[model samples]
Target chain A: MNPFSYARASDVADAIRQIAADPAARFVAGGTNLIDLMKYDVEHPARLIDISQLPLKSIEETPEGGLLIGAMVPNSDLAYHPLIEQRYPLLASAILAGASQQLRNMASTGGNLLQRTRCFYFYDVVTPCNKRKPGSGCSAISGVNRINAILGTSDACIATHPSDMCVALAALDARVHVAGPGGARTVAFPDFHRLPGATPERDTNLESDEIITGIEIPAKGFNANYSYLKIRDRLSYAFALVSVAAALELEGDTIKEARLALGGVAHKPWRDPAAEAAMRGQHAGESAFTKAADLLLQGAQGYGHNNFKIGLARRAIVRTLSQAARGMPQSQSVKKIR
Target chain B: MAQPGTAEPLRQTDVLPEKIQITLTVNGTRTGLAVAPWTTLLDALRDRLDLTGTKKGCDHGQCGACTVLVDGRRINSCLTLAVMKDGAEVTTVEGLASNGTLHPLQQAFIDHDAFQCGYCTSGQICSAAGLIAEGKARTADEIRELMSGNICRCGAYPNIVAAIQQAMERS
Candidate 1:
């Protein structure tokens, strides 16, 4: 690893000031992702501002009937919290489906959200990847395109964001709270991650000095019937080939509302407003779920090797939505609409 | 590729840099060390304290070859800074045995033939101990999920699972 100055911050304000003092400084919480990048020579920070001691590890009820999750809360703690398990089980399930127990115990919520993609080309110093080094080129476009993005991708980069928590958060309409030299501000979960446009290097909208303070998820009626389904080649510790996080609000037999997001298929959490719009006022059946899933995958473009991902993602979304709807205690047998 | 530990010293100052003083309680004994800030907990335990039970398969966090218990919770010590943990309790594979008697997990592992190369056995044993402490090995799926971080290149997952189950049954 590269040699750098390290300082443990006593408080959140001190940590913000430390990062603001140096543009090349980075805040280290879990060190699961950043430390690996540093060792691989992909990232070389001049200074490391350690904020693990900051009092940001809490989960509490907000004033607006929502849950406020502190940024420093470990993944294991969040996944096992009683309130989270009862109210938002999808979030708990999503966190559990990521990494492993050891990594979850050490990984923090803030660090998980800020994790970079696991693109093989991006990690290899010899390969050309725009996300790792701007303007070099993206070898993933033609090489090992199986795990590359099928939506919200550009010619410059085809990498997908490797996060399960963000997929659930995006579906649940969470808000990210950030604090920096300019004070505090809140960004909607969907707006937190930026698409790979001209600047593929920038993953999120956060500034260099900004620090994530907490995330707030508003209480919704559909959360009780939420589910997260991740489809991968192996069972555990592998990135999702295609994942779906969905919440269904059923008014007897009719669908009142639906929240859906797709992961491992886009540059960010692919939340489809059209799918949500189509699912409203429709009957809770296979046709409704399949139509909504088809609407979401309408614009997905697949490479030669990744053409199967489209079908796999479509099936995953349909299955997750059907499962969410079936949680409403109805013995209804619906035909397959695919 | 450069040799694992033979990369040219980035900073060529012969005089060792200023060392941060820290006291770590390993197993049950307290040991003090003055090490560089960049030194990881894995290197501190294996190189300085002579606790070589913690292996270093991948210096990065991709492999769980350096998993250790930090105050009863499992963490990748290769990714943790030694100076960050002060007066913290750490447990490695060497700490599992007591009075020349192997721990139940170790005994079960031997009986079940859980490892082949034995290079990743230390980390696997330490990680399994921490997993049981954290109540993570409840179901077979949970055991597989919790143990996914520790990879056995020899493909000894079935025997590893059996060893953990045997230890759980004994407990």
Candidate 2:
């Protein structure tokens, strides 16, 4: 890590102003991902504006009966928050299934959304990576890419976003609240993260000067059944090879509404409304689920090593949807797809 | 007088050009130190403060060998900057034992033979200590899931789980 001047932001305005003034400065929240990148020489900031001390640490109830989660709220706190566990258990389960206790204690909600891909080539400075350095040829395109992206990938980059919480939030219709030099704006979860198109260096649609202040999870009617299932190499402390967040609203045995999002397969949290629509008014069973799974993985073109993820993701969707339909507890959601 | 939770203003001369002076309440002792912005909390504890109980297995936060308590929460100290945690109370493995007595987790580790090489012991114990405080680990499976951050390459997981369960029952 290079030497940098550190300043703690007293408020949101101060954080934005400080970062806007220096293009070389970056906000340091949680430091779980940023510090790791700095150590790997993938990121080198001249100044660090510490936003951890800011007042954005509350997880509160909005006037509309929805939840407003502060950006600086630790992952563990958000995961175990009474309102989150009760109302948005899928988000809670995804978080707990992503990282271990120690990491969850340090990682923040906003930072988790901005976490970089875990692609080996992106971190290895010696190797050429377009995501790490624009115009630098992507090594993962020709190198080991078992964990690479299979959806929303471009010729420039094939890195997948490694966030399980965001996958659930995508299914729950969450919005990101950001403040920047222009003004404050709300970005829908789908638009917040950008696919690795021409400019793979930028992971999010967030401007360089903007600071993520909070996340707003709108009060949704689909609260009957939900499941977040993560399939990884290990039972714990490993990134998801393929994960599914399935939430269903059913009338008796027929699905009235549904939301499906996938992780470990796309540049962003992969959500297809068509797949969700296929389940409407249909019986919540294998046939309907298999149809939705097929629609969800329709254009999922996989890299060589990660071709197995295509099949793994399809089965995971089926299993997670089954669990959600039965209203099984989220504890049974964490499984290793073989 | 400043507000209770408000942070103190940055003093230019406190850093001596590149190093900044920050107060950290480590092991219940309030101490002031100066360090560069790049210095990790693990380095501050081991190199500057001479508290070497926390081992650095992988400084990238992948391995939990550098686990320490900040505000009673276990975090990989290697991943956090020392300057970022001014005014926070940090507890390392050295702080676990009090007044010449071993912490219950430490005692249980010995009783259950929870370690082989023991490089990751302090971190494992510290992480287990934090887990115990959270009061979420009810069964051996839950304990294993929660404590998955701390890696025991020596393969003493069975004993480690046994020790944590024994400690949880006693408490």
Candidate 3:
């Protein structure tokens, strides 16, 4: 890794001021992803503002009966938090289904949201990647792209967002609280991450001077019946090929409401209102689930090697919804990989 | 591609930054050290502090050979910067045995022959030690799933699982 000046921020204001001073400066909370990218020469920040010491490691209950997760809270702690496990079990399961025990211990909730895609070409400095180098072109477009995106992909890039927690957050209608040079603001979960449009270099809509403070999960009725299913090449320690986060509110036999999001299939968590709308007032069964899945994958187009992801994602959506509808425990059904 | 640990050409600058001082309790010893901003915790332990029990396999955090406990939680030391962990407690494999007496997990690994080449033994033992402390894994499947970060190419997983189970039962 290249040498850089490191400074520990005293608070959020100090962090924002420090980062705003240098364009090449970045905030390092967990260093799980940033340090790895530095080793691979994918990132070379001139200055690192260490925000790990800041007091953002709380898991508090909002007055509206929702959970407010601090950005610096470790993934392991957040996953096993009594409030999260009891109320937002989908988020807990999604967190557990992403990384191994060791990585989860080191990863922070905010850092997990900012994790880059595991696209092989993106990591290999020799290859051409639009995300890595603005106009270099995407090698994955014509190379091995079994893990690339199948939805919300652009001609410039085909990378998928490699986050299970973000998928669950999108399903639960979570909002992101950000502190920046301007001031503090909240961004909807779906809008926080950006699609790979012409500017594939920008992974998120967050400004360069902004730092994520916390993630606010609104009290949802789907916590009782939600499932996070991740399918991967291995049973553990690998990235997801296709993962589904499904939550349903059932009124007896008919679906009163539905919340759905997909990971490893799009630049961001793929959530379509039409697909979620198809689940409302529909009977909970294989037919209705399949119909919703088809609606979810309607406009999904895939690259050469990753074309199979569309089918895999459709099946995953159906299976995840079925599990959620039955309130079946999401244990060992999906694998955790980081 | 330059693999990690290779010395890279330093960029020419007018002024060089000063090393950052950090205090850490290794095993049971509280030590203070100054490290460069680029130095990883794994490098500080192995090169600076002369603790080589922690192997550096895949320094990019892909392999768990560099696993260690920071504040009693298992993490990839290779992925953590030394300067970031200013006043934390770190436990390496060398810290497992105290007063010439091996930890129960270490003894269990030896008794069950949980290692062949032994390249990944230290990491496996440390990770299992953390797992036991967490008190989450109850069954063999849970053990295997939780220990997936530490990869043993020699295929010593069954014996490792058995050893961990024995240690769990004893504890």
Order the numbered candidates by DockQ, best leading. 3, 1, 2
| Global CA lDDT computed for model 2 | 0.90
Off by over 4 Å in 3: A333-338, B1-12
For residue A22, give model 1's deviation from the true position in Å. 1.0
Task: Tell the DockQ for candidate 2.
Answer: 0.32
After superposition, which runs of candidate 1 have C-alpha atoms over 4 Å from their true positions?
A: A221-223, A328-338, B1-17
**Native-contact fraction for each model?**
0.47, 0.56, 0.56
- Tell me which of candidates 1 and 3 scores higher on DockQ: 3
TM-score of each: 0.93, 0.95, 0.96
By lDDT: ranked, best first: 2, 3, 1
lDDT of 2 at A95: 94
User: Chain B TM-score for each model?
Assistant: 0.89, 0.90, 0.92
Any runs in candidate 2 off by more than 4 Å, and if so which? A221-223, A330-338, B1-17
lDDT of 1 by residue, A231-317 (tens): 777767789999889898888978888999999998899997999999999998889989998999988998778889999998888
Cα displacement (angstroms), candidate 2, residue A65, comes to 1.8
Question: lDDT values of the candidates?
Answer: 0.85, 0.90, 0.89
